[model samples]
Target: MNKAKKMLFSYSFLAPSIILTAVLGLYPIAWAMRYMFYDYKGYGQEKFIGFDNFRQIAEDGLFWDSVKTTFIYAGGKVLVSLPLALLLAVVLNRGLRGRNVLRAIYFMPTIISSAVMAVVFFTIFNSYNGILNQFLMKYHLISKSIDWLGPDHALFTVIIVAVWGAVGNYMLLFLAGLQNIPDDIYESASLDGAGKVQQFWYITIPMLGPVLQIIIMLAIINALKGYESIMVMTGGGPVGKTEVMYLYVYKLFFPTAADAGGAVQQIGYGSAVGFVTALIVGAVTMVYFFFSRRMSRTF
Candidate 1:
């Protein structure tokens, strides 16, 4: 076959996906950008008010509060989930009894639907007659059941659930990184009389640096864009204590009147919120890449 024909065949295979992405992904972003400069309600007229949406977003206190909540939720998830995942990965990577079964058990949470898991957690955290409270009371930990989903505790509840659902996936990633390490490296370390703790700190961690960087970046992005669990569990409720950026954007374009109970959509404002959020996420990801250094050493 001619070189031209070979290149054409390879290019043709990617054409459909390229076109689909442009249409579905790029087009919407372009559309939103255009409308973000205007006052575009769910329907009817769209008034072009330059930078007003952006200004409104900046001046909005609730929006700022949501941003803070998002960071807290995201930070908490990374802090709790990643370390737990690393621990589980290290344990499971060992030649333990029923390793496969334990791995499946650990990973089961990731496969469960987030919405469904939120509902289950909601039931489990109910202040009155919930399993968690009941167990705590049984052990005499508290004289009364504490409200887990109330305003005071709502954010922590969401964070705990997010950590539980995320740990398995992160653990699997760590396991894959761990498996890539050569057995000879560890055998040599053992010959040098290196203790297990020394091996983990001096060898395993340094070797897993590249993978750790990827996991941290992903965890940050996922935490910032979080919506599903907060939606299903809290609905940004208990006076919006658990509200995050995406949930705030969702409420903006899809609000139901508090008392009159009519749909009130603000597409323009929602677009602005989303655009700002994208900017923040993009900046964070870029910063992570810029500052991250190589930790792996050549054996």
Candidate 2:
């Protein structure tokens, strides 16, 4: 083929992906952007009410409550899972038997469907007649069955489930970063009588700094954006206790029979909420980047 023809052929290979992205991803975002300022229900005229939707959002106590719950859930998941994942990666990076098998076992959850995972956890954590309650009763661990999915504990329970699903993915990331570090650095440190903990703190951590930052950023984003499992498990909960930002946005767009004695959708308001939620996630990412820069300079 001639050079121009060859170039055209190469571009043709990317045509489908470009078209699909424009249709599915780009189009929806553009639509939402246009709708955020309007006051259109699903089956009405496209009324452009300007910043009224944003104003409504500011006054929406439930939306702000959802934001608070989101931060709590995201904070709990990242704080608990990242350290656990790092510890697991460090141990498994050693010359342990069946480490590969163990890695696969840990990563299995990442591949599971969020809906299926939530269902399984729901069975285990049901307020009454759950497997966990049964086992606890059998072991006499508590005088009464614990309500894992109750309003009081729903947020905490969702955090635990989120951590469980996320740890494996972060562990693999940590493992990859750990593997990239040269063994010679550790060997030289060992020769100088640096113990394993000292080598880890001084050498491994420093070497893995760039990868660690990326992993942390991903974790924060994932924690903030994730709501599928929570949606399925509690549908934003017994009383919005487990409702996060994304889940709240979902409910606003697709309010179900469970909401407020049969709810209706709010497409315009939901679009506004979605846009604000994206901004919140973006703001968080910027803050992390800011701190990471300072941290890199400090070390």
Q: Report clashes for each candidate as comma-separated counts.
A: 0, 0
Provide the overall lDDT of each model, using Cα atoms, as 2-decimal numbers: 0.89, 0.93
lDDT of 1 by residue, 92-111 (tens): 99999999999999999999
Give the number of colliding residue pairs in candidate 1.
0
- Taking all chains together, each candidate's TM-score versus the true structure is 0.94, 0.96
Model 2: per-residue lDDT, tens digit, 128-209? 9999999999989877889999988988899999999999999999999999999898899999999999998999888889
Q: At residue 273, give the lDDT of candidate 2.
A: 95
Find the candidate with the highest TM-score and give its number: 2
lDDT of 2 at 29: 99
Any residue pairs clashing in model 2, and if so which?
A: none
Model 1 alpha-carbon drift over 4 Å, by segment: 258-262, 294-299
